[model samples]
Target: MAKYKAPLRDMRFVLNEVFEADKLWAAMPATQEVTPDLVDAILEEGAKVTENELFPLNRTGDEEGCQFSDGDVTTPAGFKDAYNLMAESGWMGLGGNPEMGGQGMPKMLTVLFEEMLYSANASFALYPALNSGAALCLDNHADEAMKEQLLPAMYEGRWLGTMCLTEPHSGTDLGLIRTKAEPNADGSYKVSGTKIFITGGEHDLCDNIIHLVLAKLPDAPAGSRGISLFMVPKFLINEDGSLGERNPAFCGSIEHKMGIKGSATCVMNFDGAQGWMIGEPNKGLACMFTMMNYERLSIGIQGLGLGEVAYQSAMDFAQERIQSRAPGGAKYPEKAADNILVHPDVRRMALNVRAFNEAGRAFASYVAMQLDTSKYHEDEATRKKAAALVALLTPVAKSYLTDRGLDCTITAQQIYGGQGYIREWGAEQYVRDARIAQIYEGTNGIQALDLMGRKVVSNNGEYLKLFAQDIQDFIESNSDNAAVQPYLEKLGASLETLMQVTGNVITRAKDNPAEVGAASQNYLDLFGLVTYAYLWARMVAVAAPKAEADTSGFYSAKVKVANYFFARILPEAAALAAQVNAGADTLMDLEEELFYGE
Candidate 1:
């Protein structure tokens, strides 16, 4: 595989140019202290850590995987040292609250850093990624005493965090979780149950592992409402912030997964583990979601990151591997055969990966910007709007980015021909690593359902309308610019199609609930396509004028990718709309038992 280099230029382009991140940061009081120089320094250092410490482990970690014995889990060689370096260097707390010993950087900035982390080593990245998400949950829902006791150490990397939601039987349906939390006289509860698929549940990298587990109280209501959140640590903490005896939470076993093998996916056996309740009783699902929302976006970045590494590897291979002659005769006539880069098909694959990676970066940053705004805007109305956009786009960011990440990885593998399938090339590892992003953090299918049912249908498409209005407003303002006219027109048409399809889904879903499930996936794809079109249109508007006068061709490349997206990718929205309009009859008409075919 090619050497992993952080795409600093494109990251800068998206943050400083496409999104004007500095200006947005300046407007928010919470981010006002963040200067452009500080942001650049952070990005540069983040790149260094990921490239130097994490990138080298990508292959080795996958090869060695993790070791498990008894109740102990051990990471691959060099992983412990690399993790310590990451934590000691303060990368883990880049987005943590400042008052709690964190840098409290804006999400807009950290999202880029996160992309770099995932691109370098996804398995290793999961360690701190879970910590960040866990910290966010505690910061929001945990009591003041809990935060004071845990937040500082967690931010400083003395401890790590994990989220335990899934069980052997309860996967997507949290209402069926059988974990039991019995209240004790000391105000803490004993959390007892077996939680499966818990990432970083028991690792040697940190002294203590804090688990945000979901369970039910003795007299709690039934179903999801009965579920409550708990903070179960691997080792109990004393009043002086010292570690006490080991807690009952034990890693019973680990799963042999297809990808991300270095990260311990444990089956945690909580044998009456002493735990503290977070938020109110029977509201554990809500608290868990507070972290899950953060994690969903992080997992999406996993997709974007893996796609980037795969694309770089593919581009490297295409430029060096000599194959058949070019269509218009050999570009390198002196050589026996020209490199595969000379072929249009190779270019199409490369360009497709590039197009999605760049757009995904911009889209993720845009969402991060909204996140910063929602948290620190100071104005109630602005915060509400930003929060709504975050809700509407979170599913898109998680699902579309992973779907495209998988597509890009497969395309990258295709560029290597037969060599791609071999483990020696490292290309296959990327494919395996990226596949889980779509499955976890709520499967891409679940994301579509959430997008259609909760975020859209439940609100009567109010957020969707707000989003469409933003696109329409952008089109009207830039309609006169000839360079971006085509993109604007295409985006406008796609927006209209999205609106029409959304109305159809809402109308059909009212009578038959199955319609939401049937149309959801396609509806999400359409929403994602049109959303990308809007961002690409904005990107082209910024790049066109610069391309006209620049000799570097930097801006020209941006314009070319934007053009490719509009012409080739944006058209997917039309087909998705048609599929969504096909309604539930085609899907629900078939008998359930017949699905197996006699």
Candidate 2:
């Protein structure tokens, strides 16, 4: 409802204290060139850009929306200006590799900036976020010629990018996609199909729109194994690296959405468009994953940022809005009513949001740090370990952050009561915005299935065990920090419960096909809470010593939230644990005739 402010100081603390990202960056040769001063400088600049440039355009952009007509789409008023400002300031390429046109900032820091961008305006954030993901795929898979041709302009925001994957009848069921790519005499492919729910699908803000469309070759295998990724630009690129003529790829129509109204979710029709294959034939999913991985984390942070802003907005309102008296007594004898802050339940709800938003920030940055380690670190073992970490945590980051994003936003909305239900209050918008985060980018349920089925159970709990060992090691080493000991202990207990539950689910599901699917959502939530609990303890341990010597109340706040998380939130895992153990019989046993009170 109110203006958003970047939580710069809190972000800085998490990066330095909880993650010690600078030290990790200093060790990585690729990131060694990045200095703390540079990270700080960029953070300062990023905060201003996100707050001043992007935040102001949020409401306006939402109201004006994107104008779509006759194969053309125009961004909302002031969006083009805000985008160009981002372009000129080099914000678009903050963490882009220096080899291309990016500033080569650490991914650790970029995650925080991306959070700010999302918090400021999620609808507006889609353009650049998708661009960055497109750039990531190109940088990794495209040959030198393609990278040389596309990276600079995209990094500079002169050209934008879109991902075309979903077909009318296919989304989660990508195996059913009907898009096709036929080989051409020019060594390019003629891509033909319709893609729905394509973000950044069409816009006049850039000189060109680069599309990463997935299509199947004629000789390819059935299902997802057949899909291939192709680059289909709206305008044919000239040999001299200039714009030629309009290509066959164009917007068929745009979907009206519940939130992120400013973003153009278009139905893209690629009709015999000349497109270059991005990766090896039939390896499209992997290539697209390069971008999906980035997008997944970016989307997760979207929820995180919105949660932070919503929580902050709610806290501000709670402190100022005078309403009912304290339940026990009249605290404000001279006033007409007491502030809502006096209500214990309201405080509990507000504190829960704070706990997740802050801890979620640490968790996200920590994962980003792992990304940098996996990519830039020279040590083979470190890279391997970090890679494993990424595989283990990516789904969690996507699902958990957004799950909490929804929960925290709801809590913030609860603080507003009736006002939150009405659109005018803006609290409802955060809830709407947060909802998609759960559904899109591989639904949270899918994320949970990935974590439990692939990451945990498939490897026979190797990643699960390794990761828990890492956290347990931290707890053992830092047991001396009295302030965080209890939370750390609870995390240790939760980890044990998770392992036991994971093993039990795998064992029980061996006999029943539906068992795993039935318990997956609850299992993921349980896993996420444990992960956050560990991050919370890590935060408290780092902040306790820092707070002991400093005058600032930041660390004290950290300690309080960690405690609150343990006392108020972590107990839900017990309920989730019980539900996960119940198996599928309760859900699947009921006959179809039972519906309609049969």
The best candidate by lDDT is 1
Candidate 1 stretches with Cα past 4 Å from truth are none
Q: What is the C-alpha lDDT profile of model 2 across 298-388, one tens digit per residue?
A: 9999999999889877877787788889999888979888889899989888888888898889889889988998898898998899899
Q: Of the candidates shown, which would achieve the greatest TM-score relative to the real structure?
A: 1
Model 2, residue 213: C-alpha shift (Å): 0.6
Model 1 C-alpha lDDT per residue in residues 335-367, reported as the tens digit of each score: 989999999998899999999999899989989
Give candidate 2's error at residue 247 in angstroms: 0.2
Least lDDT summed over 10 consecutive residues: which range in candidate 1? 1-10
Pairs in clash, predicted candidate 2: none
Candidate 2 backbone overlaps, count: 0
- The alpha-carbon lDDT assigned to residue 300 of candidate 1 equals 93
TM-score of each: 0.99, 0.97
**Candidate 2 Cα RMSD after full superposition onto the native fold (Å):** 1.6
